[model samples]
Target: MNRTLHRVGAMCAAHPWRTLTAWIIALVAAVVLGGAVGGTPRDDYDVPGTASQAGTELLRERFPGLSGTEARVVVHNPAGGQLDPALLDRVVDALRAVDQVGVAGPAQPSADGDTAIIDVRYTVPVTDLGADAMDQVRAATGAARDAGLQVEYAGQVPEGEPTEGGLGELVGVLVALVILIIAFGSVLAAGLPIVAALVGLGIGSSGILLLAAVTQVSTTSPSAAAMVGLGVGIDYALLLVTRHVEGLRAGLAPQAAAARATATAGRSVLVAGATVLLSLLGLILSGLAAYRTYGFATAIVVATAVAAAVTLVPALCAVCGRRIVRRGRLDVTEPQRPPLTARWAARVGRRPAVWAVLALAVLLLLGAPALTMRTWPQDAGSQPTENTVRRAYDLIAAEFGPGAYAPLVVAVDLAKVPQDSVPALQDRIAAVPGVATVSEPLLSPDATAAVLTVQLEFSPQDERSGELVDQLRAETLPAGAEITGVTAVFVDIADLLAERLWLVVGVVVGLSLLLLTVVFRSILVPVKAALVNLLSVAAAYGVLTMVFQWGWGGQLLGVDHPVPVSTWVPLLLFAVLFGLSMDYEVFLLSRIREEWLATGDPFQSVVRGLAATARTITAAALIMVVVFAGFMTNADIVTKMIGVGLATAVALDATIVRMVLVPASMMLFGRANWWLPGWLDRLLPHLGRRGSAELDDPADAAPATEETASLEPAASR
Candidate 1:
């Protein structure tokens, strides 16, 4: 792997412009081809084998209109009077005339007579609606607005607006650039990684767009993919660039330095990328089409990032050559003092048990909240107050009861249950403990199926709403009746994820253990890494629970009140964080293992490895945390949940696990940290990096320790 990467890096570096041109060509081709043939991302909420899914499928076959999208035009007379009936008729006529609309209802008026709801149904599913669906709805309601009526929209039709992001992502990139400059103290070095990351991101983003052409990619997938891609892309490039700088300081020629850096750091990059992709494979095991699309989209971006780190970064480094090095530092001949990180490592190593115990305590405390974590699918009620959909949700909750905002649809197969028994079924459902009201059954045109809308006493976001759904499925409804709607579908999705969450975690953890063991040639190290990463992930989940569920600081992130954590967050976070946290682990452990091979003293190896890679790891982690946190600015609660969860996990992993626990634990374990059973070692293929041989000079090595028991006292060092 090292030799092959070395040759590729050298070739690219030796012909810099050619390499740049090739990347540019690839980017352009991807964009042009994607624009011509790429598919758009559409959310696939279908969860097979679930009752909600079955009901939805049944409706699509027998009563297609009810299965499609729906919208509610909420109108209110702010002047404290009943609305004009003629004006209401005009509004209904306007909506019914809109393209794609299957039906516009007789407006349902509030008891106070001040507010009314016009329910509109589209002839197609939400995903099938065109880009102008919302615009068309808005245009139809303009006349009502013009006549001094307060109007708002809610439900699936209004939910399709493209979420506002991009700005936060752009801000994150700019911040990353600044951090890189400060870390490297060279503008050229700082710019190289950014450039490489951008090139790769271009291709990755284009690829995601193209992917939409073939599969059902969720609307959220692109943003999620970009967030992961950008952070990892910059981090991967940073790793390679840092190593190239080390090569230059060691007096290697520009092309040789680039080649050697690629041979070593590039190998870690590959392994890290593979781990991320492998972790994403667990998402495929989730058995949800939406999650599978998310996994594929994110994997594509990560793959491109790895490619650019190995190919484009080295070429750019070679092109810049010695200029990447700070001028005065290159010619240093005096004995260099230990950096602050090395001093810290030595201190921790001196009292391994103390530091390890303290770090574990802190992590456990932070993770405790996860024990009470609750999850539900986000809905319009969770939206910020400033949004029209949120206003619609609030208005409906205020005037017509909160339950009316998300009424459950009970689909009945008329063939199994006679039409004469339909009235009895409705009365049976309405008698259930939580049922608020039940609408008269509406039969399909063919009279083969019928649907009854059931309102609950509690709002759709309430836990009782979900419990009620469970009650209806288990006891209340007849055999021919299946409950499905926005609320019911969400409940079903949550249940599906709960069942599959363990499957995903097991796959990711088990596969990651295997991969890391092979890469580091150590069983304990991989096991330790997994354990620590789980702590970080749990801590993140705990934080999310506090902020979003407990409403500890929900207002700060545009969350007006406490709400359940998004259903998909825990599963997604586990898959993503396990891989991402392992990125730092791989870089740190790879360096430590390289030093162990060179010095054959585990104590010094830990100290020297900490010193060598600490700064790079810190910078990379900061970039990732900042990038992930930036997404908190988005209005979408699900997006905010993901951003906060990822940022928290990365930050905790970098500081608690990497800085304190890992070194202390390594010191406690001593030589056992790298030990592998002879049989297992023989069974594993040689996949570890070239290690110490990649360095051009022994002068680059950290100062040797005299005692192998632990680092010398900070004073003596």
Candidate 2:
């Protein structure tokens, strides 16, 4: 692996323009082709094997019109005056005349007569709707707006102009650039990673657009993909750049430094990237189309990042040459006592247990809220307050009730039941405790099936709504009746995720454990790493629960009230966070193992390894945290949850887990940290031998003299 990476790096460095031109061409082609042919992402809430899915499929097959998109045109008289009945009729007629609107129900006035809602059903599904769908709706409602009524569209209406969500990513990159300039003290050095990351992210985002063209991709996929891609892209390049700088300070030529850095840090990058991809595979087990798309979308960006890290970054490094190294007035020429991190490591080493206990206490305390965590799928109600859909939701919730925003659809097969009993069934359903109103059944064209729209007394995100779904399924609904629609689908999704969350966690953790054990040839290290990573993930979940669920500090993130954590967050967080945490682990542990093999002193190895890798890990982790946190500015609540969750996990993992727990635990365990049972060692492939040889190369080693040591931080050594 080392030799292969070294050769690849050398080739890129030797012919810099060729490598760079290839990436440029790829990026341009991806952007242009994707824009011309790529598909728009649309939410498909169909979860196979769930009752809701079955009912939705039945609707498509039988009552096709009802299965298509539906929206509500909400008109409110904010002045508390009654709407003109003549104007309301004109509004209904305008909606009916709009293109693709199959049905526009009569305006239903509120009890107070201050607001009215007209239900509009489109002939086409959401995916089939044209780009001007929302524009047409807006145009149709203009008359109502002109008459002094507040007009808002809700319930399956197309989203308006895309949010300025990319701004968050831009800010994250700018911040990372500043940090890099300060750390490397060279503008060129600072710019390399940023450039590579941008190119990679551009390509990856275009790839997502293309992917959306072929299959269902969630609206949330792009934001999630960008968050992960930007962080790792810069992080991977930063690792190589740091290593290349170390080689330069040791008197190696630019080409040699790039090759050596590629061989060493490049290998760790591959391991880290592979682990992340592998962990994403666990999402396939989620049995949800949205999650699978999210996983694949994230994988594309990560792959591109890794490719740019190894090829584009090295080419840029070679082109820059000695200029990449910090020199002139900024250079330190004399001994500064041992690096601050090394000194701190030594201090912790002297009393390992105390540090470990303190770290654990912090993690455990942060994680306590997870015990009471609740999750529900977010709806338009969670949208930013300024959004039209949210405005519609609030108006309806205020006048009619929150439940009016999300009505459930019941699909029933008339062939499986007596036609005369349909009215009796509706009566029973309406009599159910939580039932607010049940519409009369509308039969299919052939009269083989019927559809009923049921409105509950509680909002979609409320726990009572989900409970009613279960009760209707198990107690009230007939054998052939299945509950579905957006609200029911969300309820089923919550239940599905609850059942499979642990399974995905187990798969990700088990696979990662096996991979780490094989890579490091250590039993205890993999086990310890998994445990600490889990702690960090749990702490992140607790924080998410607090902010989003318990409403602690919710207003700061733009949420007006508490909401259940998005149902898929815990599962996705576990898969992504566990793998990301391993990035720093691999970088740190690999160096420690190299030192251990060379000197056979566990204590010194831990200290040197932590000292050598701490700064890089800190910088990389901070970049990741900021990148993730920046997504809070996104208009999507689910995206905000993911961003905050990822940011919190990375922060805790880097500081509490990596800095305190890992070092202290290694020190306390001593030789056990490297102990692998003989049988297991024999069973595992010898993956580290060549990498170990590469690290041990005298030519690649850091300067041994005190003066050089002082000039360079332990990271360079």
Candidate 2 residue 244 Cα shift, in angstroms, is 0.6
* Runs in model 1 lying further than 4 Å from the true structure: 333-336, 694-717
Model 2, C-alpha of 132: deviation from truth (Å): 3.2
Error of 1 at 459 (Å): 0.9
Question: Tens digit of lDDT per residue, candidate 1, span 195-284?
Answer: 988888889999998988877788788888888999899999999999988767655667877888888999889989998999887899
Report how far off residue 47 is in candidate 1 (Å). 1.8
Winning candidate number (lDDT) = 1
Inter-residue clash pairs, candidate 1: 39-212, 39-213
Each model's lDDT: 0.87, 0.86
Kindly report which residue pairs in candidate 2 clash with one another.
Answer: none
